[model samples]
Target: MLHLILPSDLDALRELLDENPESLLDVAAVVNCLGTCGLCERRFVPVAPLVESLEPLYGDSKGLHALLRHNQYISLSEAICGFCHADPGLLNMFQKMKKL
Candidate 1:
């Protein structure tokens, strides 16, 4: 299983932070995976640049923690993962809309 970071994931993470202030720990846990599939045990190449880029978007560690605790963030993560894994068409549509 490929484990590339998706823009939707970032957006979801951001939305999550916006909705709550205590989800940072959860977000950190997810980020720590570093491309290893939790279920399949498949090892994917780590995208360091992608991860680095996300760091600033969340501001500080505290900010990230808040996001993790946010309900919206959790929901967004589920939606993003569903789109990425089961509905690429939906993801593409969302990306296209963002371009406009």
Candidate 2:
């Protein structure tokens, strides 16, 4: 649970799956799960405490706000490493690639 890793032995995949945060099998069983639940909605979780603490060091609230504002999915990454919303970030990048 503390860490996840896949071993070299192909037969040992089951054990690795067991330790995996998101199981490859029976994925739908994960309820309110950040990884695969399509219906689950994301609430705005703040990534402020760390920056706020360091804010006094920088003494630049405006700059900090500007930096944090664009990365609205900060908490999403901090909370669940792989869980990301399908939003303008992905679509925008794809659109740019298409243009290129």
Candidate 3:
């Protein structure tokens, strides 16, 4: 399935890479896993400090090489939605927050 929000244009992709080097690994990893994963809309969070600490790597290289160089689980899932057995109270709270 095509990513609804992610750009399909090469220049747009490059622009995104240039604008936010910190997102390099995350973008690369997601692109690499595209069309292969079952949960296409799944969201993930970095382990923190990992992406922030990748500036030196960004200066050296700018692809998956720089992205996945560190031996850290940066883009691992912090939370996920759209699943079975969700907590009703939590969902209610989210809905209420949306109304505020």
Highest lDDT against the true fold, candidate: 1
Question: By the TM-score metric, which is better: model 1 or model 3?
Answer: 3
lDDT of each: 0.41, 0.38, 0.41
The predicted structure with the larger TM-score, 1 or 2, is: 2
Over 4 Å off, model 1: 1-9, 32-53, 56-100
User: Candidate 2: how large is its RMSD?
Assistant: 15.0
lDDT ranking, best first: 1, 3, 2
What are the models' TM-scores?
0.25, 0.28, 0.28
Candidate 2 structure quality by residue, lDDT tens digits, 2-55:
123334454354444334523322221222222322223443333344345334
Residue 36 of model 2, lDDT score: 26
**Clash number for model 2?**
0
CA shift of 90, model 3, Å: 34
Superposed on all Cα atoms, model 1 deviates from the true structure by an RMSD in Å of: 14.8
Q: What is the C-alpha lDDT profile of model 3 across 1-100, one tens digit per residue?
A: 2244345665665566566544544543544432121233333334333334433433333353344434232333233233311446655665665578
The stretch of ten residues in a row with the least summed lDDT in candidate 1 is 70-79
lDDT of 2 at 83: 28
Residue 19, candidate 2: Cα error in Å is 39
